[model samples]
Target: MSSEVVRFEASEEFARRMDAEDSLRSFREEFLFPVHDGEPAIYFVGNSLGLQPRKAKTYVLEALEDWEKLGVEGHFRGTRPWMPYHEMLTEQTARLVGAHPIEVVVMNTLSVNLHLMMVSFYQPTRERPKILMEAGAFPSDQYAVASQVRFHGYDPDKDILRLAPREGEETLRTEDILDTIERHGREIALVLLGNVNYLTGQAFDMAAITRAAHKQGCRVGFDLAHGAGNLQLSLHDDGPDFAVWCSYKYLNGGPGTLGGVFVHERHAHNKALPRFAGWWGHDKQTRFQMGPDFEPIPGAEGWLLSNPPIFQLAALRASLELFDRATMPALRRKSDRLTAYLEFLLDRLPPGVVRITTPRDPKQRGAQLSLRFSKDPRRLLEKLNSAGVHCDFRSPDIIRAAPAPLYNSFHDVYRFVGVLERHARD
Candidate 1:
């Protein structure tokens, strides 16, 4: 926390003043904002899908041109050679997650990488076959873990243990999570959790959880779908056995783009570890030989299944360049202030109208704030959308809004709250 005080007020003028003072404000011009009523809408849904960078089109077009100019030779002689295209993203991706270049790789989608990581890290013996995880995890994670357990000849109902929040609570307590790990230490083989809860916007202490799980002799991993570009994480220092994340969210890669993975350097050269083999995962020097013997590439690249997707990687590179110029430490500083300002404004709304489900503590969350409304939130969100507030709504009662540090402005948050307040009065 800086000594400089942030006194939030419920006025548009105050919002403009903050925006003027924000050093990162100019970066907002780089994105393509959604238009509503012939003006840029207040977009607060970066947690679901990020706004496209204006440079993405140019990058993709460059790749398209290279492919057209050079046919088969493009693999080795393109503007950015297709053969080693993913290598261009490795350093930036690693820096974003606080990992070494050898430990990070951009490959398959989130679910596919989760399954691939499980193949190597989730070995279960007769005595310790259970997998532990947070209850109410994203549906994709829940399904992936359950299906993996079933594939390994274990019943998901008996082998998968889900830790839930206490009755009447909206989020899990760190103490509770540790205590559960202690109590179930013997039967657990692996502990997998989403670093930031998608629905509640609660960020977990990954290092602490990893320490606790490792103490209990359990292998741990994270689904960083919401944490990757939103929070400052030290994946290598956190010491999880492996972690996976989608690039489409805060990473601002285009929709359904490729995902990222991190494997601890301790396992980087371990050839004995079991993994599903692929041509791309073969040793790069000998890969063209096409030998029948499976020679795994050391580190996270060993998990890749196919050649890189050039267009998607090109778009991702554009976003990464913006992030490089902005830098993580600065973005995180602005993110903390932006989310805090959102909480401040929401607290001033009429009593009992809406409740914030995400934690108030900066350490426990990222840029997103999930609101649980008193009435049917679906209708409320629809009304907000009609007013040009482009946030996301979950089933039943929650609305998730995120003021992305890279593009969103303080004025945007102010306008979103104003729409919600007017909708409540209506």
Candidate 2:
């Protein structure tokens, strides 16, 4: 249902009724929630760390059992062998980000994958030596980009271009982004952006940005840390050189789990491309031969620098099964409605008590709603936690509350708003 057609009511009965009518409500039972008092806490922090999936333990145990029984032989003997285990995630990971299986691979952590991608794609020359990125990006990304530029013997202050929102604006305008690319395209060797900005919950026009960057002979990539499971992405159609994301947040892969990478199919068989190689990324047919030369496997797997952690892969596999069953289209549909309902309820608060930093249009965001409070946001966060509303506080004032459609119900959103209302009144 579109937001314009449905008029939302702010009563407890309304919230329960919506939850009752939800098609995806059963999926909520699959996850384990944190307890507040005796009841399940109102979990709206999926944008940070997602709740653990109940099946994760079972999956991990299967791996452990195999390891104990077969030892080194488990590499080739188990139901899901350790040797080609990462391949098991390729198709599902591709579907999640809308890419070909050949283009996707499950491997190292997000930053590690990001640095690997930059090594090949961020080939800065004397004429075009700059890296373009969003201002106020996540600190990790800022540090990564700065260090990359410095490693190439370029001064980050001189070579890195950080784009910011206009004066007094909380989010970026798409037109301005395109204009900047048009003007600076010649000097930029690469353009890296968060597919969805972590702070303001702003989703960018990635396709447009990619096209603009390509027109200027610049390679483009995205950090999908907030976008992967939360947004319905079309990375292949969008035509970015590469993209990377972690599985711990919206993906529910447990804490500090594995990450994924997408490399466009056009570059799949380019063995001459410079990369940090490892034995695992070698061609399967001759990998056991222990050849001195690295005959890199075609596509995204070719970028792997080491063998992955099997336990983390097992944990992520459990969540990917849920995603495959739930489907991004269905999840995205419910996410829009849930976020709209949250916005409607937040709008009812007294003027100047709070301001939403996220875009009002659902097209421009994911499940997260960033709330900027007029009062002590940290104190309010403490009250919300005490009252069984679980969310996260960013520095200064913003509180990011994400109602994950796979687990969070409309009633959860309602109860959360009720707590915020009481605190605002106080």
Q: Scored by CA lDDT, what does every candidate get?
A: 0.92, 0.92
Clashing residue pairs in candidate 2 (N, C-alpha, C atoms within 3 angstroms): none
Which sections of candidate 1 miss by over 4 Å? Answer: 1-3
Q: Could you estimate the TM-score for every candidate?
A: 0.98, 0.98
Instruction: Give per-residue CA lDDT, model 1, range 15-52, as digits (tens).
Output: 99888988888889999998999999998988999889
Cα deviation of 239 in candidate 1 (Å)?
Answer: 0.4
Candidate 1 lands at a TM-score of 0.98
Stretches of candidate 2 off by over 4 Å are: 1-4
User: Candidate 2 lDDT, tens digit per residue, 1-426?
Assistant: 332456689999999988887888999999999998898999999888998999999999999999999999888998689988988999999999999999999989999999999999999999999999998799999999999999999999999999999999989999998999999999999999999999999999999999999999999999999999999999999999999999999999989999999999999999877788888888889988987999999999888878889999999999999999999998999999899999999999899988999999889999999999888889999989889888999976799999999999999989999889999666
Q: After superposition, how far is residue 182 of candidate 1 from its true place, in Å?
A: 1.0
Count of clashes in candidate 2? 0
